[model samples]
Target: MIRIIAVLMLLIPGLISAYGIKLMRDTLFNDFHPIFFHIGIQFFAGFLFFLGGVAFIGGFIVYRDKKKKKQREDN
Candidate 1:
C-alpha cells in the first residue's frame, strides 16, 4: 500500500511536468489555454510548473539515495 501511494505521488508530479512542457510549447505557437489571459503569463506559469515538478522529483530521488547510502554505511 505504501509503495502504491509513493508511485501515485511521483506520477502526479510527472504529469504536471509534462503538461507544463505542453503549455510552453503551445505558447510558442500562439496557442493559449483559456485560463491564461496573457501569453507571457502562460509561458511564465509553465516555466514555474516545470521547474517545481522537476525539483520535487529530483529532491525525492536525492533524499532516497542519501537514505540508502546511510543504511549501507551503517551495515
Candidate 2:
C-alpha cells in the first residue's frame, strides 16, 4: 500500500546511517575524524526527514482534495 511504502521510504535514511556508522566503526579510520562521520550522518538524516515530511504533507493534501471532489460529485 502507499502508506506502507511511504513509511519504508522514511525509514531508509535511519537504516543507512546505522549501517554507515557500523561500517565506520569497523574500519581502521574509526579513530580519526569521528566528528566528520557523525556530522555527515546527521546531515543525511536531516535531509531525508525533510523529504519524507514534505511527501507526507503532499499526500495528505492530495487525499483531502480527492475526498472533497468525490463528495461534490455524489451530491
Candidate 3:
C-alpha cells in the first residue's frame, strides 16, 4: 500500500546514505569517480527523505480530514 511504500522510502534511503557515508569514511580516495558517485548518492538520499516526509505528512492529513468528514456526515 501507499503507507508501506512511504515508510520504505524513508528506510531504504536512510540505509543507503549511512552505507555511503561509511564507505567514504573507511576507504581512501585517489580518484574523482568515487567522490562524484558519493555526491550523487547523497543527493538522491536527500531527495528521497524530502519526498518521503511529504508523502507521510500528506497521507496523515488526508486520513485525518477524511475521518473527520465521515464523523460529521454520520452526525
Candidate 4:
C-alpha cells in the first residue's frame, strides 16, 4: 500500500514536468500559451515548473534510498 501510494504521488510531478515540456516546446515554435501574455514569461515559468518537479522527484528518491540503506546497515 505504501509503495502504491508513492507511485501515485510521483504521477503528479510527472504530469507537471510534462506540461512544462509542452510549454517550452510551444515557446520554441513561437506559439505561446495564452496563459501568459509574453513569451519570456511563459518560458521562464515552464523552466521553473520543470526544475521544481524534477527536484522534488529526485529528492524523494534520494531520501528513500538513504533511509533504506540505513535500515540495511542496522540489520
Candidate 5:
C-alpha cells in the first residue's frame, strides 16, 4: 500500500511538471505581462518536483531495506 502510494505521489508530480514545462514554454513565447507570476509558478513546480522525488526515493530505500532484511532472516 505504501509503495503504491509512493508511486502515485511520484507520478502525479512528474505529470504536473511536464505540463508545467509546456506552459512555461508557451509563456516564454507569448507576451504575458506580470512575469512575477510566471516566476512563482516555476518555483511551485520545482517544489512539487523536489517533494515527489524525495518521497519516492525514501520509500524505495525503506522498501529495499526491508526486503533485504527479510531475505537475510530466511537464510
Candidate 6:
C-alpha cells in the first residue's frame, strides 16, 4: 500500500506536465512569448521536484529509524 502510494506520488509531476502541455497546445496565443511560458513551467516543475525529493528523503529516514528501533527492541 505504501509502495503504491509512493509510486503514484512520483508520477504526479509527469501527469501534471502532460495536462499542462495539452492545454498549451489547445490554446491560441497571439502575443505571448513561448520561452517565458517554458521557463515558468520549468520553475514550477523544479519546485515540485524539490518537494518530492524532500518527502522521499524524510520518509526514508523515518522508515530507517523505525526499523532500527524495532531491532533494538527485539534484542
Would you give me the overall lDDT of model 5? 0.61
Task: Report the poorest 10 consecutive residues by lDDT, candidate 6.
Answer: 23-32
Per-candidate clashes come to 0, 0, 0, 0, 0, 0
Ranking by TM-score: 4, 1, 3, 2, 5, 6
List RMSD in Å for every model shown: 3.5, 8.8, 7.9, 3.7, 6.4, 8.6
**lDDT for every model?**
0.88, 0.57, 0.56, 0.86, 0.61, 0.56
**For residues 1-75, could you state the per-residue lDDT of candidate 2 as single tens digits?**
998976786566556555555544544443444554575564554455555556665666577678788534443
TM-score of candidate 2 against the unseen true structure: 0.42
Instruction: Please give, for residues 1-75, the per-residue lDDT of candidate 6 as tens digits.
Output: 998976776566556555455444434343334554665564555455556555665666577678787534443
Residue-wise C-alpha lDDT for candidate 1, range 1-75, written one tens digit per residue? 999988988898998998889889999999978999899999999998899899989888878888787534444
How do all models score by TM-score?
A: 0.86, 0.42, 0.44, 0.87, 0.42, 0.42
Candidate 4 deviant stretches above 4 angstroms:
70-75
Worst 10 residues of 5 by lDDT: 27-36
**Stretches of candidate 2 above 4 Å error?**
1-37, 70-75
Stronger candidate by lDDT (1 vs 2) = 1
53 in model 1: Cα distance from truth in Å?
Answer: 0.7
lDDT tens string, model 4, 24-72?
Answer: 8889999977879999999988898898889889988878888887434
Model 3: lowest-lDDT 10 consecutive positions: 24-33
* Model 4 steric clash pairs: none
Highest lDDT among the candidates is held by which one?
1
**Candidate 5 lDDT, 1-75, residue by residue in tens:** 998986786677667656555555555666344543675575556466566655666676677778787434443
C-alpha lDDT of residue 34 in model 3: 49
